[model samples]
Target: MSGQAQSPAKPPPELSTSDASGTVSAVAGTLNGLPEDPQMTPLAPPRSTPPSKIPLRPRKIQKLSSDNLKPSMTNLSASAPKPPSSKKNRADARRSSSDALAVVIPRVAARSLSCEGEVETALRHLCAVDPLLVPLIEVHPPPNFDTFHSPFLALTKSILYQQLAYKAGTSIYSRFVALCGGEHGVVPEAVLSLNPQQLRQIGISGRKASYLHDLARKYQNGILSDSSIVNMDDKSLFTMLTMVNGIGSWSVHMFMIFSLHRPDVLPINDLGVRKGVQMLYGLEELPKPSQMDHLCEKWRPYRSVASWYLWRLSEAKGGPSGVASAMAATGVSVQHHQHQLQQPLPPPTEEQQQQLVDPINSILNLGYSEFHFSS
Candidate 1:
């Protein structure tokens, strides 16, 4: 080994400007020392080749004839979309939809006391709920609804009887029925066919004649019908009936109870009912019409029978005299008094007349006979 440290070895040569210009050549020269300048030599022109000697063939063209141009009916029918359904088809579809709905949603049979054993059932229910009603129920015979009259006839009779005494109303009703030919002929058509003069001749007032015509027109227009009225719920029937010119809530209540024999009806506007309720419950003041529903809630599903007892209670207290005093005390008009008197009641028999002076005593002494309510 040398006495002094050997000198550091030299590094390998790096690419410089001269090497890039191809002026210097080394064993590791790039691109074999070729010049990078484009002007160094001109490139040779591309050689041209001669076109091929083979000839091209042309495609043959053909023209379409009239027969080929014409559209095919079978193809058109198969490709075209169908037209919209006709009116008859739409109507049939609606009918089918209605039938399907009818099957899915069953019709509710109307609740009525006129049905067999309904009054008996109602009386049992009232007796069970209210002990006080037992005495009254025991004394009074169950109301009979066997005399089912047509809704139109009942409604017409009720209108004629409004604000009139029973004897006078009965006389007018007889004449009105005769004009229509008979009770069976008292239809909407017959009522509408009668002129105002004809109605006036039968003792119907001008206002009342207008009311009757309005009712008949409603029936003709499909707004009201016997079946519709019979099948309607109490609230809906009240709303519908009150739309007539002269029919009020009081009239509707009477018709529902006496004619339709609906069980849950409580005539709140009725003076007799109010008096009876007051007497039965011993209230300091008469119940407001609005309060009647809440007070009579327990008698539900048989309030009609309970109301019948109340009428009897009112009658037993003082007959028409007590009712008249109540009307006067309440500031009720003469018209209202007449309206109260027009409510359906069986004419007082000789025994009933005697019992009127002391109804409770009479009921306990001589029990009621078979009495049926009708309009």
Candidate 2:
């Protein structure tokens, strides 16, 4: 064993300058293959420590208390900020809700012309749309009108004035009011108390007497209350009031404009409005009812106001002579359209038919069991 070990260990190889250059080149290539410059920094040492041997921070698991486990509304409320309770906040919310509703809801701008400012704005809009209306506007100041709180009395007066001269109708209305005890006393109950003979004595037609009684009974029975009439929209009121024995479309239109002060009644069946349109545009003939709606579209939302002016225009210079002069000034000739006027009375529905028979049959003493209403 000593002899075998006797071979002396060889000395380490000494590198020459060429070999040193080659070794330097090999080291440079290996350094280039490394992720980072090993020449500038030392390589990290391999870890020998076991995972369990390494020191670590202990984890904390907190247990929930009995109070925390059961979530209470009171606790949640206490944790959160309170909502606003101010009146201003409520009003702002209401306004925002109203604005949103306005987008969804349809607006009836036509009924908004009751105020003076609305009238003026409408007039300005009309003037801007049709320059020809300027002369008519200049010829007359805008009419001042008001709504009658007593729709019943207004409707009664309308019935009495149907087809009669203004002065004569006023006289009959005065007598009728006196019979009912006063203007204020002319309610449904008072009207129902008067017999047909009593109404006849006051110069009311037998048919009109029935109409008055029917109107009174309707009011008494809560079918057509003053409040309901006042609150009804134009089309609804027109439908409702026209169901009465004597009230027709023309009467409804007049009542809507003068009594209810509805702003947008065209009254196309009205001879006065047609005559006014004729004069306003200087057409050779009167405009037809179909054309009336289209021609006077500009006067919408203020047609009642315009109708008042037209009535004035019709009465002025003995009916339409004044309109002619206004037309001559413009020298614009509009085409005349002639169409038959439509009957304002629609066929009675089942409900209306029932109302018609009861109130009307009670008042009229004719041998017949029922009577049909006609305008």
Which candidate has the top score in lDDT? 1
- Clashes (backbone N, CA, C under 3 Å), per candidate, total 0, 0
- Write down the TM-score of every candidate: 0.57, 0.55
Query: What is the alpha-carbon lDDT of model 2 when measured against the actual structure?
Result: 0.62
Which pairs in model 1 have colliding backbones? none
Worst 10 residues of 1 by lDDT: 360-369
lDDT of 1 by residue, 1-375 (tens): 778999899997875654544433333244577444533333343467897776477666788899888999889989996443798877888898899998998532335776787888888788888988898777656555555567787788767766654456667878999999998898999999999999999899999899899999999999998778877888999999999988877667767776677778887886668778998999999789999999899888778778878876776665333223222222334344344342444454444332221111111111111233231
As for model 1, its CA RMSD to the true structure in angstroms is 23.6
Which whole-number lDDT from 0 to 100 does residue 219 have in model 1? Answer: 91
Stretches of candidate 1 above 4 Å error?
Answer: 1-111, 319-375
RMSD of each: 23.6, 21.6
Model 2 lDDT per residue over 1-375, tens place: 755658778998998665565566667767889443334443344467766654487778888989777888898899986665998988888898899998998533754444557777767766777787776677666544422236777677656755453345557878998998887788888888989899889888898888889898888887888768767788988888888988777667766765555778888876657877898788998788889999888766677767756755554523422222212112212111001111222333344323221122111111111122121
C-alpha lDDT of all candidate models, in order: 0.68, 0.62
